[model samples]
Target chain A: MKPIIEISGISKRFRISHELQPYLNIRDRVSQIFSGKKATSTEEFWALKDITFSVEAGESIGIIGKNGAGKSTLLKILSKITPPSSGKIISRGRIASLLEVGTGFHPELTGRENIFLNGSILGMRKNEIQGKFDEIVDFSGVEKFLDTPLKHYSSGMQLRLAFAVAAFLEPEILIIDEVLAVGDAEFQKKCMGKMDEVSKSGRTILFVSHNMGAVSNLCSKAVLLRDGKIAMIDNSSKVVEQYLHDSVQMSGKRRKTISALDKSFTLQLPYWVNNAGEEIPSYSFGSDYKLRFDFEFHRELTFLNIGIAVMNKDGSRIFTSHSVDDKSFQSFSTYNGKMTFDAHLNIPDLAPGYYQVLFGVADEHTHDYVNASSEVEVILDIAETHKIKDGANGILWHTGQWKKVG
Target chain B: MEYEIKPAGRFSLNLSELWEYRELIFFFTWRDIKVKYKQTFFGAAWAVIQPLLLMVVFTVFFARNFTIESGNIPYPVFVFSGLLLWNVFANGLSNAGNSMVANANIIKKIYFPRLIIPISSILSAMVDFLISIIVYFCVLFFYGLQSTIPSILLMLPLSLLITLCTTLGAGSFLAALNVKYRDFRYVIPFLIQVLMFMTPIIYPVSTPDMEWVRTLLLLNPMTGAIDLIRSAVMQVPVNQTAVAMASVSSLLWLIIGISYFRRTEYYFADLA
Candidate 1:
């Protein structure tokens, strides 16, 4: 079978201006034209270089990359939003791109009118929108505000409405960017399910996202981009693993000593470990864990606070634990000698996801914090074991048992 | 198979592709019209009020102070006729010129005939022009003037066609140029102001005594269309030479505008 879309050696170059200002006024431009002064200086940036790919009909391909790795640029080129600087692309069948949720929604227009407007903007015919209008509204769940102007709806409601309109587009080939990064977790799951149905319907899909789990679940193949070039392309799971391994290597060794701070205090750590004192890169849910830190005090200190913060992958702090909070360790003082301290934490029954640990030391009295170069960052991957059921929600699970009280 | 996209040549109008996206053009025009009146208190009434009030100002100031010729018609009716066509051209030109930059978000995300933007803006402006024409007819009715109703009916549509063509020509040029130069943003309003004086909106085409000045005004494409409208509606004397010249010039501007627009359209997404 022939490929649905073929991209051959496509590259794009953007002219980067080094001037002090982004744009010049008409007066300056006119004077420059009269004086015959050319532009001061500029450099050429190759956003994509020799990116070649092909997609068979009914194939779901994921384009994974770090920011500025030309993922969005490639999608734009495929969508024909911009012309490539070099090479060619041949595509069959109708193609639709949902680069953003609400590309042309008007605030003054009511939700019903905006549904039709946004539907047409995404290349839907008027009758097609009318035919599916009820389904779209039902999916968006904005029935009460359907007649209200879009400006009155909250942003989340507006996004759902926009996505609802786009969700009904039945093009042969779909190009999607990181538009799923909006809304709440449940809405994201709905969007992912919609994408799953789209891919399963024997239509070609090209998805670009940073969500490794979503990509692995919905895409059969994945392409990793690094430095504007194709770094790897293979099965989704293998590609995701390779991408993560490359990232872990890029983050350097997990353990290091901090001597650049005030020499009076030296700090060291072995990052993350389990109850058995063995270093761990991952742990099962509901396990006991410890983050060990070694501190050497060259001089006696009045008061010091060591804190550990757990954050999700998006860098939102989940919780913070401090040594000063412990009743037994509150009045404990360190002498002019080395000592090992560990913060024992029970990994809350978290929904299977990635988390990071941030360690810091502060002077409790003066409110001064240590400016250490070797700040420790440990990534903890929590996997769901056979012990938990599938109906769990949110980041944390309460330890209390549930009962059929009714 | 390979689909290549180089910089399009000067002649690539791709009219068939535009024809395929005709429904999108309709939607865009509808969207502009809906959004234009969505938030306003007076809504579509502003369309009639704008030109009607302008006619009043021009009649009181120019017709009274300068004793402008109305060619056997009342001053208010004569000037209102001229203002009707002028409003369409002026509004269409400005709206079409700014449509591309204003819709940059959609342009950056999707691919469609870029010409649809300027065309839809012109169509929306036509809606306003149609509303204002009703007021012009009422002004004639108030003046108790006997209009050549059949001729008016026949010539109004023709004159509007000429106006639409001229606007598309100039507006498309400005739209494409505004994407790259951006100076056209300022230049358009200034040019429209100067053009109103040159197009005989408040004065007759033959008001100037000098033969050369009359010929100069006839060089403006709007001159012939406005002359055609006044002659057909108010039964004014027609200048065949000026009308012929104006018709030719309007078509020429249309060709120039579309050709320039087509040449620069491919770069619009990048520049915008």
Candidate 2:
């Protein structure tokens, strides 16, 4: 079969201002136009220096990268969300994307109204969407609240319905950004299943996500991006394995930054590893496991309270736990000493989830806080039968039992 | 079939293909409407309210208090007729202005005709125009004015053409400016504010006796539209020469606008 899309020698560069170049107000512009002197100096940033790759029909290609690595930019280019500078991109099919969940949705519109709205945005005909309406709503499980204004629904519900509408619409090619990070695991799994089905049905898919495990499981091929270039593109496993390597390496870069708004020293994690040298697993809600973080301090630090906030996929504070009041690490007077902190709590009452935990170190005396090492993502693949929470970020697992005092 | 869509350079707009994408146009239009009226308590009736209320204001200010001219017609009917024509054109132009930037999410994440956004925005305003026109006729009847069939025939298509030209020209100019200098987003609304009063929506074209003012105002394409509309409502014999001159100028603007827009369309998705 002829390749449905062909991209070769594609390059993109964005001009960045060293400083914000204020647009001349009408008066200033009039003067400048008349005077003809250069009013400002301009700088450039190569968002995508030189990119070259291709994908065949029915292939689910995952794009992975660090922030500003041009993963989203490449996806945007592929999806025709924007134009590429100084390069040629040749595509020969219809494409759909959920760049941001619920983008085309109006908060005042109900679920049913938004479905039609979103379907059309994806290029599906009204009749075509009308025919598939039931399946989309049923899949989203928003049928009960279909008539309610979407603003009343939880953010997760809005994401679920938006994804449903985009996924169900029949497009020859599909592009999806990190939108899958929204909603719970069961819903994400359902979304992945739908994407997989679409790929198998001979549609081309380009996916950009930070979720390495999802990329490995759902995509046939993957591209790892770094510094706005294609660092690696191969079979999903190889790409993900390299991605995992890069993620692990990042934690080791050992950068220093002061947390703003307080005199807290935060160590940026360049890479992370478990005791076995295995990258930390992707996490979901209520996962049964333990995580450990090791950090070093320059100044003689003492009397510190440590708290780790496990942020779910949405950057929410899923939960925070701390070391006890009298807790003291194996102290050291010198620079080259390691303090290992262990968290052994069974994550409970979380929606089927994926999470990244941020570890913070603070001076208990002056309340000086520092961001320390963080665990790489850990995934908990729970079965759908554990669907207990109804569209909420159920993070609390209350262990207290009630006694019949009456 | 194998497809590798890396850069969005290969998009080609086949008109026949856009026919297939008509549902998309309809959906985008509906989305615009929902977004506009969603939080408002008045709902779809608000579409009627804008031009109607403006008509009331125009009637009280210019038509009643000031001696603005409409050929052989009461001031209320004249100003409302002009409002009907100008309101639709302004709405279309405004939609075209912001359409590219507003759909940045969709444009960045998928591949469709980039032209579709502005076109759909203009299409959506057609619904509002239809809604308000119903009110236009009611006011017409209250004034005991009758629109001749021939006049209506000539004016309707002429007004649409004028709208097409002015919206395409001004919207394309604004869309391009919105990219490099996003300040145009603010500038556009203010420009429209000055534009509304400048057009004959509130006041009819100055009488031929004040030919200089008419000549200067005729530079605005909507001026021609308002004239065609007045001729439609009052059954006054239109100045064929002036109407013809306006039509020629509108077509010229249409060509220039589309050309500029096509030249700049390639950069929109990138900067927007």
Q: What TM-score do all the candidates reach, one by one? A: 0.79, 0.75
Writing each residue's lDDT as its tens digit, candidate 2 over A113-227 gives: 9888777776777788889999998888888999999889987788888888877867787788877765655887888788778888888888888766567777888998899
Instruction: For candidate 2, give the lDDT of residue B79.
Output: 72
TM-score of 2: 0.75
lDDT of 1 at B198: 88
lDDT (tens digit, per residue) of candidate 1 on A241-334 = 6665554454435455674256677877535577777766666677877777777888787677787777664435688888788887756655
Report lDDT (CA) for all predictions.
0.81, 0.69
Candidate 2 per-residue lDDT, tens place, B128-215, comes to 8888778877777687664454566567887777777777666766766676687888888788889887776766566545877778
Q: Which structure among the candidates has the greatest DockQ?
A: 1
Where is model 1 more than 4 Å wrong at Cα?
A20-39, A252-406, B1-11
